[model samples]
Target: MNPAEGAGSLSAAVQAGLEGTGLASLSAGVRRLMDAYRSGEVPAAPVLTSAREVAAYAAYRMPATAAATGAAFAQMRRGLPGWTPATVLDFGAGTGGASWAVADQLPDAAGLTLLEQSGEAIRLGQAILAESTSGALRGAAWRRWRLELSDAAERAAVQDSADLAVAAYVLGELTERQQDRLTELVTGAAPAVLLLEPGTPAGHRRILAARARLLAAGYDVVAPCPHQLGCPLEVPGDWCHFAARLQRSATHRRVKGADLPYEDEKFSYVAAARPGVGSPDCPAGRVVRRPGQRKNLVTLDLCDRDGRATKLAVGKSKGEAYRRARKTSWGDRWDDAATG
Candidate 1:
């Protein structure tokens, strides 16, 4: 569904909140902060430092972030349909965008705990949630705490044992040691964890690092990649990311100064569940790139369960497979049942 056509209740509430506030007041600050984030620099302090900044960010970035997060979670559901999470732990929940994504996907999720450092962000998120029709989000616990990977006590406040734990766009600011510590803490707390980053090369590397750590800790891989083996994207000059296209609402376009009706949010993510918990079965591989179509042939690049990348060609003479291939968009999956 297009985000503009069907925004989650929390997102709608966020938009309403931004509209009530002077959203344009902090537009310049939001643009500057976003540029820094795009450049891969994690600031030491909160980017949204005031009501205006928080509102500006909510108006400008929330839709795209929520859309990207929902796409990642959809992949997780495809891989683990049997895994129904009752609770979620959102780390660094800026205006609770990711939490809203979780709520949109996991309708039965009755609990939410958001850990964030900035009081301003927390207040804005609470305001949005209060305005939301979603009972889960409205009832969520907004915990104001700094993220400290070095301190065990502090890390414990990150909701150590939720059914699902999410860290969206939060790892880039930390050092390697901090990342490792954060991973250890999260893995210890939750049986299932989802980590998301920007679509940049650095973001994919972060996902790879988390994947390795999770696998070593006895977690099973789910979504995007079908196998637990080392990533095949190790070749130089290559990275793995997925794109999610979201429709831009009028306010969203105005805030971001984007004239396009739709924007594609690119993200790299890893979702994994521990050994005892069973996940649903999905396709053995995913179509990582857009299928190229010619007069009669559809060509695709696939990432397989064996941790290999291979190209496949389906001609018009190929019957049903070709017909199916013609319908696939990027970030879609297919298996032997359909193509072999």
Candidate 2:
């Protein structure tokens, strides 16, 4: 499905979940949730404690989450064309935003499992997904599993094998040890893994760390990074991130008390797959920043397969290369062939 259709479907599903709910209470809950997220401290308990909070979260944050997740999935598809996972496992899935993204991006994913600690989130997720037309989403299994579990057997039982595993906007909520454990669990369960975090220095650091672990575990880099070597942006105060712009609905605006018709969800992500599972046709370079244009020249900042970050200027003299550069946006794959 196209982005507009996917957004419309998600908005409809959220509205279905919020039917008969009080908008005043939901708006207040959204403010509280936003404050909690901005505080940068993991709450002592599940954030979606009450049914109202879950609804508030679904109405407020789910769209942006879906947008960001979809952007990451698009990059993954570019890296591995024609690859589709039959099964998907989402860790800390919350109200299933990532699942919705998968349905839109990889429609052939037949089986989906969503693991979350909040009972309210699980129930609300089920309700939201039930409104979806996609059979894969409607048939998804919502399991209440805590990532902090210490028992090996309990952890193993919850770690069902799948073709792709996702942990989106949840890693920062765990302790260092818990993060390590969750990484190991997901890596063991799936041949491919996708990790997403807020587009902040800390978030980029988490993704970098996770990328290192995946590489050590014999996984190959798939998206965002063009090479398996160390990230060149690892220098202090410099980090890699991208933005996904999403149009906001009327209800979304009311819940967030914002007047903007759209918002850009900045996020950092890493997609990697086990050696043989990754594509050999990964792009030679990825546009790392917004392209700068002036007169007849367009300049691009890219992370290339050579494991280096560099800038290239395409001018009108370059003919087709200049046309391609003019149309390229941030987070797009850049091919050297375009210049040749």
Q: List the residue pairs that clash in candidate 2.
A: none
For residue 150, model 1's alpha carbon misses the true position, in angstroms, by 2.7
Give me the overall lDDT of model 2: 0.87
Model 2: per-residue Cα lDDT over 1-340, one tens digit each: 3344353489888888888888898998899999889988867777887988988989989989889999998888778865788899999999999989988776677899999989999998999999888889999998888875467875677555788999999888877777777888888889889999999888898888888888888888899999998898889888999999988877888989899888999999999888777454677788999999999999999999999999999999999999999999999999868874
User: Model 1, range 155-227, lDDT digits (tens) per residue?
Assistant: 5555456888888887886778778877777787688888888888898998899889999998888878888
Backbone clashes per model, in order? 0, 0
How much lDDT does each candidate structure score?
0.79, 0.87
Off by over 4 Å in 1: 1-11, 155-160
**Per-residue error (Å), model 2, residue 145:** 0.3
Q: What is the lDDT of residue 275 in candidate 1?
A: 68
Model 1 weakest lDDT span, ten residues long = 1-10
- For TM-score, the strongest prediction is 2
